[model samples]
Target chain A: MTAQPDHPDAKAGHTLISVDAMGGDEGPAAVVAGCALSAQANPDIGFILHGPQEQLDPLIAKHRELAGRCDVHHATEVVTMDDKPSQVVRTGKNTSMWSAIESVRSGEAAVAVSCGNTGALMAMSMIRLRKLPGVNRPAIAVLYPSSNPQGFNVMLDVGADVRADADDLLRFALMGTSYARNGMDLQRPRVGLLNVGTEEHKGRTELKEAYDLIRAQGESTGFDFVGFVEGGDISGNRADVIVTDGFTGNVAIKTGEGTASMIGNRLREAFKYSPLSRLASLLAYTSLRRLSKKIDPRRVNGGVFLGLNGTVVKSHGSADATGISAAIKLAAQLSENKFNDKLAARVAATLPAEESPS
Target chain B: MTAQPDHPDAKAGHTLISVDAMGGDEGPAAVVAGCALSAQANPDIGFILHGPQEQLDPLIAKHRELAGRCDVHHATEVVTMDDKPSQVVRTGKNTSMWSAIESVRSGEAAVAVSCGNTGALMAMSMIRLRKLPGVNRPAIAVLYPSSNPQGFNVMLDVGADVRADADDLLRFALMGTSYARNGMDLQRPRVGLLNVGTEEHKGRTELKEAYDLIRAQGESTGFDFVGFVEGGDISGNRADVIVTDGFTGNVAIKTGEGTASMIGNRLREAFKYSPLSRLASLLAYTSLRRLSKKIDPRRVNGGVFLGLNGTVVKSHGSADATGISAAIKLAAQLSENKFNDKLAARVAATLPAEESPS
Candidate 1:
């Protein structure tokens, strides 16, 4: 957990970013290449790369931009995709995933980004960074591509924890609101509680209780409460921030992704069906590219660990260099904006638990 | 609630299908037109129409196929979309929805089809026809367009009861399997319990319990249990029938629909970007049309209420004539197969509750 002397206290204006260069579906090569992409894009950012030093050094050396900006942490062990979260926490002391979070926990890195096992990353994050004050459970917030003017919306509790009580859902609303404001640059994000229906009497008793709590916090929290929104509204323009329990949120996002993938496949098949259509595909190349870009899953890559003491962005396991770059961009933005500090202060101030004697 | 004498007991081979002619967004005109389309396509199907006599007579008269075949039931009241299920059950005795279900309950119609409030339809169906023995909860089964050979898969508990216990999910598995067999004509259908992940130790406690229960019933119940499936597998080829609690299933389906709708819109926008692209759209017209029809929501419009004494198909509230016709087609198919009888028998035989002491 000791700080690397090479980074040298972020070099005045430089932002030190920690990254796990192993455990992704793509090897340390893609991860190191991704770090180089982030390094080349911004001169203000420096990297603390965690993996086998031998495997990471060559990849980092190949990129001129990362030659002097990168620090290699020698982590011999790798926490695999199949490894259980609890198992990883106990045995993952020498793993790259643990060392990456350790940099953020030690305050040597402004943010930590990993394309590793999500469950293990979250588990390690909670243990190392700990929960923010007035937080019972942490949540994973992701940017969902939407029809909004910003072209994306914030959704929370994608899978940090499967269960969320009424109070926990209220915390997600506030956390999501903060994410939209600082993470996405929304001044006053509109928040909505995800429910089976928009009606007041619909869904479980816990959801109804959460609805009232979120609505009550609207005026004071400086965010618009859109009452209850359904699954469709997760991508709709109605709410800038969508809040739900991890179980439903996880299912909703995956369903959206699967549907998007299916439609994209069908579109390609449609274009390949006939000779003339194939030619047409060539003619409409730019337009099709534009559409694909608009709905690209990689464009909105990164699941942020919310309600934690420090910022952590969990990239997709199979993320390519581009996807990894997207996640690093998010982490840098959050670090620069000091999103975690603002979120923690907001949670402590607004949480009903702070006001009550429980 | 008496059967009209003019129909004369389904004319030996004719299937008497009841339908609510009001409450849909398009009104009674679309419903009658849809009935005409179904009646025109199928020779052995007769409709016992529900609505006001004056309002229904002209619509029925407009379609020559229903000249002597359609029997009208005078029910002045209509269940509006805003009306609650409990309110409808108490004061909706004269409503068309009630009359439509009554026809099925009174043994005059093989199946009941309604494009009204779903909650009301389910409540009325449960009260009128009642639940089959050993069935704790009813489910709404829907067909999702997928990569399967049948081009679709069955998903149940779409929005029947929001909360489903482990036993209820097991019931959903049986009912979904029955639906896949009879409705989609898939023998030895593969069933999967929907979860956040396919891993054995993921999701809620009820889900894990449901997984073991469903897997145990595979051999005896005649279903190929593929174990736990994630949201992505809802449209994947891994399983023909996906089972889950109504809350998660409802969200998953709606999210899929929303994503599909967004993709379709983006594709149109892509084609209309420029004059040359417009020409390309013209050349690719047939291929694109084929793709659209394949993913068209109307093509799989009906949501069948399972675990009831009689089958009831709940069509989309915003359905046009085409959507209504699709729902009617599904109702006819289930009626012809005697799907409700088989489902009831299946539940009585396979339910663990049937074998255990209370």
Candidate 2:
């Protein structure tokens, strides 16, 4: 993999992932564990754990094997979960989340990873790092589990643009398509608008507008427009790429995550209910394991914030070392490929020269 | 359970159910199975299955043990999945779907259930049954599995009203509250509006508008308005009932369903990957069985269409006999309780008598 030539610091040929140690529910424990795990697994990946020195020191000391290799950018404050996204930049000026995001904006880090409040992280990324040219909105792209044996499906705009217009959705489709091609290595991704039904006129006013815009783009948009996709469509890989507004996307993603956990808990509950189910669980062992790998959260931990000037990955707030390790690996790949720049350039080429501004 | 004395059809005494035999992917089979299962369970629950006689005969015959128990009304034609809701009602006069709906309008059936094209069903229900006296728009209500071991969460308007206003949401809240009270048998159901955040001013325009309207009703409305809830709020059963527009609610429910299945499939895949997991699955047999039951679709097969004059349940089109059975059971319980009448009266009492109309 090679970074895009247009990337500001692509010629430096180095990968430094800034970790927001103050982010996530479990705080520094999970963040420290994840950073150490990533460092141990990938010798080439470097980390900058950003947080208050006093708070981060003990955790770093516990993982001395990674101490000599990792760097810490001491940040005094933290961004609380309840804080509004608009207030994140102002109130937590010295917070690790802000600094980590700034690190990427300044080319000090290849990517910034946070498990903090998604809205704050998104706000910081958009305001500080800024969006790539030709992209009106930067989307939170998620790789959802597909029923297909091939691989996962990618969708974007998962809560960044709540009141998204038709043009915004059109831009999201373009960005998602590029992300799939550049990030997931798909040649030409199939894109679809999330709707109540497949019919063009079946959606709400906003969705109807999006349907028309997407349809008007035609084959010239690069990605294959697969028409409208319903909620059930996500079960099967109906489209390689799906685009929806952030509110729906966020709800959908969280629902997916929560449902996964809920199902696991339910499965456990079922197995414990009676001796018959216990025996059934035993009989279904082989098939069950196969199913787990297909929908494992660890395997799908990293969520790329697309349409940004630089690549940024957000891991699950409740993620463990294994999940974090996967996130780092994903970030490393994004960095090496300079995925963001390629996506930006592709979007730019599609827009009129007079309308394109970089 | 006995019918409400105040209910208009209380004198009739009989619990009449209208089954759309032509609805569902498998047509009469699903509806017939549902009716048979429901009839066998509740001797007082009567069904009017509307469809072609030849097709309905075998389905009803399969449940011949309940021979004198059920009736099948012959409506020769059927509605195609792709047919527009407007087109179906305007042209398909003798269609099974329309005939089934007509049974409810004619006061022959206390309740109706369908698994056909959702749009067509909703359109027919609103047009024929009409919204309850004070209701402006009817909403689809669904039960979402919560992390709480006790019960699943109830969400209203999963896709019935696309352009719902503040007044429409208030009506949904009133309807949903009755569902929890009469249907789920909860006292003073905790109501909530699904939002991006818990803050009053945080959500989009429509949500904010709904929030203000719900707040204005306050405690006097006979509903315990529990304030705002996020997507994650559903997991913990933070509120007994949650309200949102049809578009978001539908996407949320479907997303949850797809995710639970995906995760279950993933776990199955994992167990088969190696001997260790296979052994683990066996040792964890009791846990696995419990989990299956926790996420079982049969347990939450039907979604009630709230704010209508009659109790109507819409099951998944692809639901099997067990799922259909559950839907039928839900329909019977709802009809016996006169859920809609209670909701409408409560809403009407809360609003000025003259201002109740849309």
DockQ of each: 0.74, 0.44
**Regions more than 4 Å wrong, model 1:** A1-10, A352-358, B1-5, B8-10, B352-358
Candidate 1 per-residue C-alpha lDDT over A76-185 given as tens digits, one digit per residue, 9 for 90 to 100: 99999899999999999999999999999988886899999899999999988888878888999999888788988899899999999999999999999888988888
Top TM-score: which candidate number?
Answer: 1
Residue pair clashes in candidate 1: none
**Per-residue alpha-carbon lDDT of model 2 for B203-282, expressed as tens digits?**
68877888878877756766788888877766656787888888878787777777666666667667766776666677
Across residues A1-358, which tens digit of lDDT does each residue of candidate 2 receive? 2333234234354577878887787778878888787777766666778899888888888985565556778899888778888877778779999888888988888688888877788888887877777677778888888875447788777777676778789888888887787778888788888877788768788888888788777587667888899776665677888889888877777767767766666666766667766765676666765666667778788888887778778887777777777788888888777777777787788764334433
What lDDT would candidate 2 get against the real structure? 0.76
The CA lDDT at B299 in model 2 is 65
TM-score per model for chain B alone? 0.96, 0.90
Ten contiguous residues minimizing lDDT sum, candidate 2 chain B: B2-11
Give each candidate's fraction of reference contacts reproduced: 0.65, 0.52
| Candidate 2: Cα lDDT at A110 | 66
